[model samples]
Target: MLSKFYGEIFAILTSVCWAISALSFEIAGKKIGSLPMNLIRMSLALIFISIFSVFYNGNIIPQGANSEQLLYLVASGLVGFVIGDMLLFHSFVLIGARLGTLMMTMVAPISAIISWFALKEKMSLWQIFAMLVTIAGIFIVIYSRNKNHKKIEAKTKKASILFLGFLLAFGGAIGQAGGLVLSKKGVLNYDAFSASHIRIITGFLGYILIISFTRLWKKVFAGLKNTSALKTVSFGSFLGPFLGMSFSLIAVKNTSTGIAATLTSLAPVIIIIPAIFINKEKVSFLEILGAFIAVIGVALFFI
Candidate 1:
């Protein structure tokens, strides 16, 4: 009986896992920079996910997967990991994870729209209205009142960088949505963990191509020496690709894409407490209200 809601359960767990990883990656990205951090994180994640794969599936490589699954999973990896994560990590560095993840709330709507086109999934009027509420919450959080009642100076370089982060966050959302849609098509009857491994491999290869082309191979070695950063990366690797992403695939496989995406997109709200207390970032009451509104929107999807 409890097994029936596996999709929703895993999706919620994915949000928690992602919140932890986002904070960890934010720290590591700030320390080593996003480019180097990207290479190292994916590399480490591949190692971890591969280890899990070997024990879980009795093989280290994707075996018995047809060309279609392989192709789409590989594409998902390249777009989601290499491109989307680069943009996301940059946003984490530029605007901090709190704002970056908040901006990424669009992943729900993006996923819904893409699933509509690709999988012929349809949304009800109430769901569409809920999506709008989610967007409104994000807008409120992004444009929240400044700390101590201060106003943001629009004509400033800092403001410009924040705007760039916003754009990067949105791009990340689109990339992730595209990847999820592709993975849904690819993971038919495949083990969720196995699918995640293939996706990582594709991202790993994509990163290798980028670094080789750009002559950034040396930077990866340099990044490995950041012991402090590597520690965080290791933790993030386990929480993210190993558990977070695999379960996301499970959610996608077991439930409607829109429902899974909406549940997993709760990271922004989950990160708020850690950001405010642990990270000591200032958050306004308006932001809290906005988060509640977004949660309401997500909850509305069940109806």
Candidate 2:
């Protein structure tokens, strides 16, 4: 019974883990900033994942990884973790988190189309319907929040900046889509955990190179002074890169890329219950309804 659903189960677990990490990362980002905190979390995540890879895979690194595997995984990290996240951050800066998140909903379909062409992966009619349902459900919840609050924290209220924000958000979707497709290719005949480590390595290095050229070393160093932020980042690293991303890879390995993307996209829905506990955000009936709708969409997979 569970075997057939294992991929989706892992994807849902990935969503839950991402919700937890996103909350922690949100706090850390407030304490420190996105770039510096990204470097910190990725560094710690590298250490954590390395240990896991060694213990679980019996190798310090992916000893069996060929050149092609390395290339694909590295590209996945650069596109997904670095470029996608950075562009989304810029969108947050320009348009606000609400709109940015709405834009990110593009990733699932974009990734689906990419996989269809690149990997010759195809979805069933039911699967397509389910994916749209899930995406639409999540969008309804996200859109409601934006409609009620409609807050876009920005220093400048420039029209050009808002337009740029839209572009960046779309770019983020494309980056993530490309990364998912590449990861599916990369992890072929490779250990998922090891592939995840390679991704972490590339993402960390990408940030390092960017910071180096931008001369943000001082800012990065300054971020290290805050002990509280470090603790938060460490926790986030454990949940996100180690657990969340690893499960994500496993999901993709076991399932089609489109299904994995849609299933993992349930983070917003999963975050609601936790929000109740954390008392950070208010939950409403619409959110609850949307979550139920999303679950119905997930259930459609089994049917």
Candidate 3:
């Protein structure tokens, strides 16, 4: 039974892995700054993925990938890892992982829309309605109302910060959506692990370039010395870029990208319990309802 839904199973697992990793990255990002944290985590993830490649692919680097595959995968790394994650990690620091990841539920709809244009993929009316529901749920969670059920004015510094954080999270969604589509294109009929390895390599090199041009090595060195942050980043690196990303590729390879992305977007719901207990966040009833509604919207895609 489970074997029949291998892609769905892995997509669920990817959500779990990503939920935990997002919390870890949030903690570390707050301490080390998002830029440094991203560089270091990518570096650590590269090592972890390389080690896995040795056992799985029998090589430390991806093997047998053609030029076209490499190009798409590399572009995915740049868009997803460099741009998307940069925005996401910063949002984590600003808004907390719970809300930041909640915002990421947008990835499913965004992926579906991108696929429609990029891959000539068609969506049913139900799927279109699903996307709207997903967006509406996200708005319910993020938007605020006053006592009279009126929209709150964003006239304060705190509101501005929250607005920026949500905006960045949305940008991250775009990056991830674009990357997922590109990954599906590149990883077709390819080994998921090796394909992930290629993406990570590109991400690592992309970060190196950014750090070099921006002269952020000092911050990177400082982050390295922060043992607490280092430990948190290391754990996140394993779960995130290594396991979570590889599992995502496996899901996309085995199933439709829309279905796989929708399943993985359950991270918002899965992260709620952890946010309440581990992070000690006070989740409101509306937030919970919004999450379920969003997930229901995503689930509609599977039908």
Best by TM-score: 2
- What global local distance difference test value does model 3 have? 0.82
How does each model score on TM-score?
0.85, 0.95, 0.84
Clashing pairs in 3: none
Candidate 1 lDDT over 1-303, as tens digits, reads: 547778878888998999899789879877877777777777888898878778887887768789988998988887888788778867876766656666676787789889999999886788678667766765566547333222333333377887898899889989988899889988888888889989988887887887788787677787788899999988998898778999999999987687778778777677787988888988878889978887787666555
Model 2 regions more than 4 Å off: 151-156
Candidate 1 positional error at 237, Å: 1.1
Whole-model Cα lDDT per candidate?
0.80, 0.88, 0.82
- Sorted by lDDT (best first), the order is 2, 3, 1
- What TM-score does candidate 2 reach? 0.95
* Clashes found in each candidate (C-alpha, N, C closer than 3 A): 0, 0, 0
lDDT of 3 by residue, 23-82 (tens): 898799889877888889889999999998898868998998899998999999889888
Predict model 1's lDDT versus the native: 0.80
**How does residue 112 of candidate 3 score in lDDT?**
81
lDDT of 3 at 119: 84
Shift in Å, residue 156, candidate 3: 2.8
lDDT of 2 at 224: 90
